[model samples]
Every structure is written in structure tokens, then in C-alpha cells.
Target: MPIVEELIKEGRIERPGIGVTIVEVTDEMIETYGFPKGVAIYQIMPNGAADKAGLLPRDIIVAVGEKRVETIDELKEEINKYKVGDIVKFTVWRDEKEFVVPIKLQQLGG
Candidate 1:
């Protein structure tokens, strides 16, 4: 397992889904990834934000609100558009179908 994954398992990173600030990995690292041609790779965190929002672990997040997210930086920037306690919507591709999920935002970095 990756060091970050181990940290998460050891309760070292802030886990917003669990309402813990000391999460093992940031949202950008946990939910987003980089790819050539700007395509993004995604990972589902079991019961994390994306998972709780109905996004599959293998789903690709293409957009957040109106911003196109093709990279982890893009995803973080898009998410920053909203503040804590806000409800944000994301667009993802699952099973070749585009879907939207609206979930409340949470605080990060303690």
C-alpha cells in the first residue's frame, strides 16, 4: 500500500467524510489523478465524498459545477470555488453515462 493509504488507514490524514481533520490524504490525492492529454483518473474511497455522492470508484470526474476538471489541480480549484457548508454538484462518467451528484462541502486542513 502507498504511504498515504497507510496514513489514511492509520488515521493520520483529515477525513472529512468521517468529519476528521487529520486525514490520511487530501481530496485531490484521494479522488483525483493526472493523465496524459489532460484526462483525469479517479479513485473511489469506499464511503468517501465521491462514493457517498454516488460516484463509482472507477468513475471519471469531468466537471465540478461549471468548471471542467481534467486534472487534480483542476479538481481542487473547482472545489475551492465553494466554501465550507456549501452544496456543490459534480459531473462524472459511470458506465458510460454522465451523471450529476450534489453533496455538501466540508472543511479541510483542520
Candidate 2:
């Protein structure tokens, strides 16, 4: 199959990833989490970009660079703008405060 051949050739999917399991912050969750708008990170991959950048579970990503993100799709759009090994600054909301973290992108499934 083409999928098998591609896997053999590339070894991995060749997509960039931040190694996070995120969910879109709903209007109700905004009140519950006390964040204006963002994607909620629930799980972090061990030793991955988020982990390396010290992003913890329950942290809400409000922006990528200067672009405000309100959903998982927006976050994906922002992340797709960068390539692997590029450091991207993420605006995070936690404990009713905002902070920035720089994370290096990594190849997904590698």
C-alpha cells in the first residue's frame, strides 16, 4: 500500500507537533477556568516541546506569538506556520494570570 511505502521511506508522518493534548475552551469552560479565550491543555507528552518549555496540564494557551487563539484549530493554524526546531512563543493563562513560554517545535511521530 502507499501508506506502507511512505512509512518505509519517511519513517514518520513528517508533521510538526507540540506534544500536547488540547481541547477548545468553551464559553462555559471560560467561566470555570477563568480564562477569556484559548485552548485548554489537558495532557502533555513527556520530554516534548511543551514539557521542555515547562507547560503544565490545565494551562490555557491564549495566543501564539501576537495572534490570539480561541480554539484548537486556531492553535493548529498558528503552529503550522512554523517548522521543526523553530522556537515559538506561546501566551499562556494560568492561575488568573498570563505568561509567555518559548517552545521548540518537533517532528511528530518521530
Candidate 3:
């Protein structure tokens, strides 16, 4: 199993939908992407919940539910507050635009 999967099974991480790989948004990244502090979507998995929700790679996630997340760890921590089948709202920054999207969570191994 992948390390992420193992972590999920061990309850050390939340089971996010196979939607995106995220990285901490640094000042350099902000200058490059023209976004403020947040978690950048490094990659978006095909046919995943985020994909289905129209989230694209390079989109910066600034908030989950009602909490702002500036780091990848904060994003993961916010995600961990919910379980599979829960729908969460995400505030994203893309192409100088900010929008909110709803994504339904899924089991890691599902």
C-alpha cells in the first residue's frame, strides 16, 4: 500500500478523495501563481471528486468549510475533521479568480 493509504488506515491522516496532491504555498509560489498563502493543488486526479467538481491543477485552496488553511498540514487537518460521504466546501483561487466548490469525500481505498 502507498504511504498515504497506510497513514489513512493508521488514523494518522484523513481519507481524502483521490482528487489532488497538495503542497504548501510559499511566497515564491504566490509570486509565481499570483495567489496568496494557501495549499496549491499540485495535481488533480482524473475522474475524482475534485475533478468532478471542476477543480484543476494549480488551483490554490484557501479555505475548507469555514476555516482558512494556509499550509498543506492545515488543509489536511481541516479535511480530517470529516469522514467519507461528507460534503465539504472549498474556497479556491484560480486565474486570479476566487470561487467556492463543494466536494464529496470518499474512502481512501474505495
Candidate 4:
């Protein structure tokens, strides 16, 4: 099983279905993505909210709403500030292009 599944089963984390594992973007990653450091998407769950919003693996999330995020913790903290069903804009960098995508947050089990 996925680590995320294990975490969910252990009640150590909530399953929000944003469905993406992220890491802090490093200097190398920033150079590769042609963007400043941010939260780098490592994976995107199939058919999940992030996937539906056009977020893909390797996309660097630079901002959530109007707040800039430089680390995974910052990104998660920003995300937690909003409730499920709230639509928020995410600024992402992919393939040397920057764009904004709106995502409607969802809870996995409620």
C-alpha cells in the first residue's frame, strides 16, 4: 500500500483527495524547472482534484491563493486555511511556463 494509505489508516493524516505528494523544490529542481524554489509535485493521484485541475507531476507550486509558498509545510499550512469546497487559485510552473489553476478542495471521507 502507498505510504499515504498507511498514514490515512493510522489516522496520522487526513485524506483530502488533493491527491498530490509534494517536496520542497531545491536549487537543482529550480534550475531544471526554470522557476524559483517552491513545492515540487512528486505525484498526482488518478482522477483526483489536483489532476482534474491540470496539476501534473514535476509542476512546481509557487503560490496558493495570494500567499507565496517556498516549502511543503508552508503549502500545507496555506491549504489548511481553507475549507473543503472552497475554490482557490494555485500558481504553478511547468515546462518553463507559469499558469494559474483553480482547484475546488475536497475531503476524502467526511
Candidate 5:
């Protein structure tokens, strides 16, 4: 099993310096369909903010803060400049033109 929840359940992950759980949020996480992406394919992340943002596995990430990301790495690097609780604008192409989707940043543990 993943260590996060298990650690939390077992009281292993204590807040404020008791070895906090760490979740990795990557760029590929926020994905969308467009450009060379002929078909719709959503990005996946085991530990990511998009997951909590209610983004599905097939949800595409078309835009972020006026920047269009074609790859996962591009997405991660861009969002890194911000922190949790910040509202970010994104264009998600589900079946038609890019649809605007605003996501709130959630802390990806320490």
C-alpha cells in the first residue's frame, strides 16, 4: 500500500515535525487534449492537486494562466511558482473548445 494514508492512519505522519507525509505533485498531472493530441487522453498522478481538484483521469489540461502546456514537465514547472490556496485558471478540452476550469491549490504535503 502507499505510505501516505497508511502513515496517517498509523499515526506515523504527525504534523509539525513528526515526519510529515510527502506527496509529489507533477506537471503531467494537469493534462488536457489538443495540438498533436488528436484524441482525448487525461494525465494521471498518484499524489497530485488535480486529483483533489476533481479532475478525472481522462480530463485534459489545455491551458494554465495563459500558458499552454503540451507536456507534463511543462505543467509542473509552471505551477511550481505558486503555492497552495492560490486559484489558477485552466482550459480543459473535453469534447469541444477549451473550457475554462479554475482550480484551487492544495498543499502536497511535506
Candidate 6:
């Protein structure tokens, strides 16, 4: 894949990331919290991309661009499709409403 090629050429692969700890929203969680299926932001690193973009804990990420992601892996996969510093629009669900947040991805720490 492109990641392998990049690593081979550059000796390292810089992955795009929004600094946040996330948890997958299971069916049980959705039923208990009355939330839709998605990955919930459990924590945000201070001054990181997510924090800078005003993303907060408990925000549910429902989509990356036009791709709907219902699990942590899907979110990660979607995020990896972009380069660091690329501004990607994420569909977030918060307080029972859905909105888009533009986040500039930063390089993830090794």
C-alpha cells in the first residue's frame, strides 16, 4: 500500500491523526444512551488537532467525509486515508444533533 511505499522511501511513515481516545459504540451503549452507532470520543489531548478544532469528549464521530464509520477501526482507517495537515470534514453527533467539524490532521506520535 501507499504506507509501505512511503515508509520505504522516507524511512518512516507519518500517519494522520486527530488526538483523541475513542471507544466504539455498541448496540447496548446506543440503547442505553439513546445514541446512534459510532465511535465516541473518550478523551482529547490538550492543544492537539481535535482540541484545536473544538472537538470534545463524548462527541460521537458518525462519519469521515462522506464515509459512515460505526467502529473505532473504521474511523482509524478513514483517517489514515488523508495526509497529515489535510483538513477533513467529520460528521459528529453531539447533544442529539449532527454537525460537521473541519479538523486538520496532525502527525501521530510514534
Ranking by lDDT: 6, 2, 3, 4, 1, 5
Cα displacement (Å) at residue 45, model 6:
0.6
Which candidate, 1 or 2, would have the higher lDDT against the true structure?
Answer: 2
lDDT over C-alpha atoms for residue 16 of model 6: 90
What would the per-residue lDDT of candidate 3 be over residues 8-106, giving only the tens digit for each residue?
Answer: 888665466637888888888778757789988988778778888999888999999999999878888898777877999999998888899999987
Model 5 clashes, total count: 5
TM per candidate: 0.57, 0.84, 0.81, 0.78, 0.53, 0.93
Give me the overall lDDT of model 6.
0.93
Model 4 is weakest, by summed lDDT over 10 consecutive residues, at 10-19
lDDT, each prediction: 0.54, 0.86, 0.83, 0.81, 0.51, 0.93
2 or 6: which has the higher lDDT? 6
Candidate No. with top lDDT? 6
Give the runs in model 1 whose Cα sits over 4 Å from its true position: 1-42
Question: Judged by TM-score relative to the true structure, which candidate is superior, 3 or 5?
Answer: 3
TM-score sort, best first: 6, 2, 3, 4, 1, 5
When 3 and 4 are scored with lDDT, the better candidate is: 3
What does each candidate score in C-alpha RMSD?
Answer: 11.1, 3.8, 5.1, 6.4, 10.5, 1.4
lDDT digits (tens) for residues 12-110 of candidate 4? 654343778888988886576566789888988788789899898889899999999999888888888776688889999888787999998877543
TM-score of 6: 0.93
Model 6 Cα shift for residue 95 (angstroms): 0.3
- Candidate 1, residues 20-88, lDDT tens digits: the string is 112122455444532212223344444555546665445566777877666665667677666666778
Worst 10-residue lDDT window, candidate 5: 15-24
